[model samples]
Target: MKQYSRVTNGYTVVDDVTTRPMVRGHNFPAYSFAANFKYLYLIFATDTPRYDYATGYLSTEGKILRGLKPAR
Candidate 1:
């Protein structure tokens, strides 16, 4: 695997591939095994498992980041 990094607007950014997924979104057995198992809550209110840092608030994959906040 490869790695990358850059500085943007004073923030250091890196690739999401630097990490591994410990838990998967579609893992039913794992969800069944959580200590706080609540069936309705799990089905209706669970957050999608996060495998990366992308939150749609900004983009960090190019020469410059998109959707950056303006400096005051």
Candidate 2:
């Protein structure tokens, strides 16, 4: 496992090996959003149109819009 330090001096860095980001971008596929929301829900409306777009390396193709309700 890779680790990093949280603090650094003028010309030195202490390898604490405990301070690290909770979420790693490489853990998820490219061009996708990964997040954790306590009250958000994935809304699926058959009658409503889904929004997806891509430009360069950014995209929302495989992701769905999350909201407070299941249908919107």
Candidate 3:
């Protein structure tokens, strides 16, 4: 699987791996927001008024693995 993550250094970094940001950018096709939890919140910026862009949430167990779904 193709995974994504960032180095553990920043102003809004959380101790948990999943809660920290996965990526970032400036314009369309940019990753503006990400979250790590039992459920992950990944929002892609399409720069339009259509349902506020595509999103994905991954539900996982602690330090192991769980489930996933694709963005729409």
- Candidate that scores best on TM-score: 2
Q: Candidate 3 lDDT (Cα, whole model)?
A: 0.33
1-72 per-residue lDDT for model 2 (tens digits): 224212232121333435454332223232322321111223333233343222112113534444433336
- Per-residue lDDT tens digits for candidate 3, residues 11-70, read 232234555444442232122242233223223423545322234323233132224345
lDDT of each: 0.32, 0.29, 0.33
Candidate 1 lDDT over residue span 1-72, tens digit each: 012222232222233443663222222233332322233333554475521224222222212243555569
Which of 2 and 3 is the better model by lDDT?
3
Worst ten-residue run, lDDT, model 1? 1-10
Pairs of colliding residues, candidate 1 = none
Query: Which runs in model 3 stand beyond 4 Å of their true positions?
Result: 1-3, 8-23, 26-35, 40-72
Name the top lDDT candidate: 3
Clashing pairs for model 3 are 18-36, 19-36
Clash number by candidate, in order: 0, 0, 2
Better candidate by TM-score, 1 or 2: 2
Reference-based TM-score of each model: 0.14, 0.15, 0.15
